[model samples]
Target: MNISTYRQLIPSPVALVTGANKGIGFEISRILAESGIFVWMAGRDSARIKEATASLKKAGLPVDAISLDVTDPQSVESAAQHVQTVSGALDILVNNAGIVNERRLNKAGEPEVIPPSQIELNTLRQTYETNVFGVFTVTKAFLSLLRKSPAGRIVNMSSGLGSLTQRSDPNWAYSVVNALAYCSSKTAVNGITVAFAKELKDTPIKVNAADPGYCATDLNGHSGPRTPTQGAEIAVRLATLPEDGPTCGYFDENGPVPW
Candidate 1:
């Protein structure tokens, strides 16, 4: 059935998740749909997104696909337009697309540490293109739709590595795995979350950041101990938060995360 027909049946809240073709993003999309929200699973690859949506459809979930490349302004605008034309309003938005380029693998195939001082400027720029700028672009594009909702929510996927407090602690477990580009980009995401939350404080819309706690995904070469489904729990919770839920905050599964 078409999106309109599906909406007619469920008529529930609507959500859009970026980079939802696989890994943590896919799990987030799955969880949101399972919760009765009509999900727009977006990704850079058209084929991948189609496949991802298909899997959800087979499971009898309310979902559709959107081809979105977070780094491209035109693509983002087009996606916003499509949503406007179809859903008219969006209730939740999860910015889950991100990348890591400064990491490498040794002969043992384990993650090799790259010192922050040695990270290339270009690598940082590339990382920000998807992780930082993409969040800004997609959020700006969808803010209008979100405002139309009675209670809008924004969930930005972040990482514990982005925490300045945790990173500064010499005893931090992952301190030795310093990846400047990836970690700093997530830090910027938290800042963006706070900025938007403050700006819309009086509105019904709530904005928050989620730390997935190093899930095993392609971004980290599948090295994390946590499963993608486990990582998606916090983001799904943030996206479906109640009107009285906290905003402008960073949280993990347990609770608040250090900034």
Candidate 2:
């Protein structure tokens, strides 16, 4: 369909998706745009952002390239300002930018796993900088614009690896795959999601975290069985949630995930 035809689907809702230059973030942006939402596809790289945006536009999706580095405060501020100037209000904010430790595993299939004791502090810090702290930075920057909407939604791209419940289970498939840095960073994101939800309880804004369920993306070297399009389902659900939808919770494709 052409861009004009795509525009006639759902009532337009403005959305900003961070780390959307590729992978699950890009898939989520495509889905949102397919549903008639105008999406700002935000990423740190100018070249990648341009390429991704051009691809989406060619596909007749409503998407704009946005230079957003979640780890950089000034960049986040600039993105928020530009959105406000152009879109006036933001109906949804999807915090999807994050990183995983490369030292342990990749597509080549690693032989040795890096244990918690062996993991470097710098690696952990870098993971948190993008996964945990980045969410806080982006959310804070666009909160005002979100508040302007009749019903605002914040979707934090989280993972089941963060669940202490799953990690403690002996039979779970991913139980043995724990990488301390990435796991702990996601746990922190869940905390941040709940905290913001509580603080905004009385308002129309809803904040929730989504577990993409092991998608085959660059983060995992395409080893995961599920595709990015499949992984984006839960996030898209939460992003366009009804007025009565639950908030301050972590969810997967099936239902609520244990914190």
Clashes of each: 0, 0
* lDDT digits (tens) for residues 174-244 of candidate 2: 99886899888999999999999999999989999999999999887788999999999889888888776
**Candidate 2 Cα RMSD after full superposition onto the native fold (Å):** 3.6
TM-scores for the candidates: 0.94, 0.93
lDDT values, one for every candidate: 0.90, 0.90
The Cα error of candidate 1 at residue 196, in Å, is 0.4
The C-alpha stretches of model 1 lying farther than 4 A from their native spots are 1-11, 107-110
Off by over 4 Å in 2: 1-10, 105-112
Our tally of clashes for model 2 stands at 0
